[model samples]
Target: MSRRLLPVAVLVALVAALTASSSPAAPRQRPRAPSGLAFYRPPARLLAGRHGSVIWSRPARGTLRLAGAKRALVVLYRSRSLTGTPIAVSGTVWVPKGRPPKRGWPIISWAHGTTGVGDPCAPSRDSPTSLAHGYIDYVYPELSAWLKAGYAVIQTDYQGLGTAGPHPYLIGVSEGRGVDDIVRAARELVPALGRRFAIAGHSQGGQASLFAASIARGWVPELKLVGDASYAPASHIADQIKLVGAFTAPSPISALGAEVLYGAAAGSPAVSISALMAPPALALMPQLEVKCEPQLIQPDSFGGLAPNRLLASGANLGPLLALTGRQNPAVSIPVPILLAQGGADATVPKPFTDQLAGELRAKHDRLDYRVYPGITHGQIPAAAQPVFMRWVAQRFGRR
Candidate 1:
């Protein structure tokens, strides 16, 4: 399915609204927490247990009606780091209102888009009026629809987003493991959930979904992964770095480039930050540690600097590029895949996803690729929602 190009004026308004909402001048409200900060900290001994084991959980707080979920929970589960170290991960589980099927409620493990690399940026930490709510408001309704359809939705905060460690950011292995392990954690907490599941994500999560599809069978053999869906997924990182390095003007998207570098450094000791970023970029590094995407994209932050200014004059991007290349989801995926792209997406350009879809096709992977003309990155999820919902239903034999 595809959409005809929208008017340029409409496109501009969409982008402007997104930018305005995330800008520094936006109204501020203290975000509500499902659990206290202490809940995120698990005992060292708990980390020694098998991956996906639930450490602890608490009933979800806030407006459950907004999500249309009957019961909600915030949980701390075990997962592995990029380097194979046992780590604790935080996430939320939302069960549908109706009675479960005799088999059980099918699971959808949701991997979210870029929310910055800081602990406070974790989506599990979002309340109705929180800083992240702008994007969440758009995405949660789709989740609520899935709940109404009787699918149990489990969203991972990934490794370190709300836990005690440097978030591996776009590091696929770490992100993918967190995506898959959370399903295990959810099922363990609620036995009413079935073993059959699908993985889905947008932007950064989109890339994570493909990575999870590639590794789910081997990583968590106990669970059955039926399909994967990606909405304007991030890909071709090496190419993006080269493109950003040539920029002569400030770009809000440059924050993502910085994130890629930071994530690479966090996931691997071999990737040196000092070698990858210039003094100018290094000076702003402290902000990446605490600020989420909205704050990071402000004019005074990463958005204020031209992409070229963020890197060293003769930076050695080999290590970072190689690590990210390994993360690209262009390779063969074992299950059927749904790949969506927006023609006007400025963040992950249409060509990047085109290249990725082409690669997947060449590999003979089961792929359903759709393009929505004039849709921006932020709009692709809603634009492609109906198609993906049906696709996911087919995967689970729903109707």
Candidate 2:
């Protein structure tokens, strides 16, 4: 009886060992995106819904400790999609290191530029990581200066860049909508924010900042938008297409093309990105989505577009272009506009800016255009920050 019990005990231990060996182990956790999206995968529609819109009210406000300066980032307004959907559109009101304005002050609608042309991941547009990567990171120096001067700064992390949605590529209306909505959102946070506002930006944002005034009437008619100061903005897509072909430096065609595919996937009604690509391209989307841009997708500089076997990947670019040119052909809105351009701006070439200046001149005599001699695309704002800030301050009566 003792021997039989001993054998049974050994068998029970063996059974336990086998069971432990066969069990599946838990998955190791990975670091979340800086934006806190590693664990959350909310659908665009869900985020755009009523409950989603409410999330705008519950912003995670905190102080931004940076470069020995701890600035406060107050979430002034959370926006809803104009598609009548509730999306988490957040705008941060950057108050300089001073008490709130005892007297009314002018507002500066600080529209940011694009670092990457990709959706949500673009450094210029996205908020969380944007601070480290794109134009905003570079311009924070100027923003710091603005804060020191005692002015109210309103910065918006436009639709798809900081939040979610198919980044509307370079579409102007979408960009303008985000800019105008954010300005109104900022002003609503404080009544003194209504004195008068100026729009300022660089590169794509330059186009956006200049065009935002034209679009403000349609998106938010309540804000008292007095003027716009656009720096080296682009108006001619045809020209940008041409410049990409001539660019001798390393280009971003393939990545840019992938971004186009993603935008096409998000904007179209009948197509899905999964349904659009060939096997290899589909597999490439996960990694390349952030890196892809339409310009790189082209087979050659002289060629039209690469034949994307993608069903919706080849979605019509008309709406996209129309949305981008929303304020083009020059409007007679007569908003006091100050236009600055760099002579050597290759990205949004001088010709494009000159064309933009020419178009604006034909449209409004009050428009001011300054073409910096020998200044390149990126150097325009840097060389002109003091000039630009002075112009911005003048509109607010601080100059």
Candidate 3:
């Protein structure tokens, strides 16, 4: 390493870590290696080919009084990695009273959407501006409702968020692996949350739920999934990127996300980011991507990533659009698959979700898809929880 450039690289790495730590688009964190103890390690493929099976654990339990319910957050987790490197994975299992509930509990895998680096970005800071305006976003309201219904809520932090290692972005296998590990952990924790779990999530989480349901059929012989309910999942990342990427308007947030994706891709051997793009685009990434607060993000920052980069990545829409089969079909499910979308969502296009559901119906079993006429991305789950809760009850055959 060049002595003159060493300080600058260190500064950049520090700034990147701090910048990522914050963000209206905040993320979670893990224990960093000791200060001044630096050794470069490349990204490894941790969760692959039946990934979660290799990293299952006994459960971790904690108690917290929340929303008038004496709920215990049982974490179904594992700290081992499929990559041969140690990685931590965990989920918050909110078990209602009666220490696992007498009649046992139906599993509700509470999936969360994208938050950039897969880490819990910022806590409840004084959102005075938005709070004053009476706005509440991403609180996982289902936790309260599911608890009241005597269902155990298993919310996964996924692999990268809070757990150690570089987040494998949009990689269903890894996320799904994390989901499977947690579910297995949950079943052992209470012993009542056995098989036949109902999966639910929004955006990125929705996608993960699909992957989990698909894998439960094979990898997790013990787990029986009855339904998969996804809300505006990024079923088509390539297309969604194209849809959002159309906002020719310049936005730093967009650039940063693209930058991260590129970095992850650059960092990912499954899909090469550098091989997909030419020099200037690849070279301009560092300069174009970074932002201090990430207050506003749009489509433009993702320019060099789209049209070609996404297509070349081999996961482009072409295959996802025409997907069908048992492992992880692109469409709905063989069992009950409920897909709800907010028509006004600016992020994951509702039309794309509709198309995905339509494709799934051709070879899928039971499926229900609803599009809230005027709702936006954030409002979809809030509006449909009543119906979702009932659907979940039905899936578990809850009388």
Candidate achieving the largest TM-score: 1
TM per candidate: 0.89, 0.68, 0.67
Q: Residue-wise lDDT of candidate 1 within 319-386, one digit each (tens)?
A: 88788888888867889999999999988889889999999999999999999999999999889999
Instruction: Give the range where candidate 3 is weakest over 10 consecutive residues by summed lDDT.
Output: 34-43
Give the Å shift of residue 46 in candidate 1. 1.4
| lDDT (Cα, 0-100) at 340 in candidate 1 | 93
Report model 1's TM-score to 2 decimal places: 0.89
Backbone collisions counted per model: 0, 16, 10
Top candidate (lDDT): 1
lDDT of 3 at 96: 62
The C-alpha local distance difference test score for the whole of candidate 1 amounts to: 0.84
Candidates' lDDT values, in order?
Answer: 0.84, 0.54, 0.55
C-alpha lDDT (0 to 100) for residue 25 of candidate 2: 20
RMSD of each: 15.2, 19.1, 15.9
Q: Residue-wise lDDT of candidate 2 within 32-146, one digit each (tens)?
A: 2234442123444434322111222222232232222224333323345435455555455655554556545556777776544444443323354433244445676776677
Candidate 1 lowest-lDDT run of ten: 22-31
Scored against the true structure, residue 138 in model 2 reaches a CA lDDT of 63
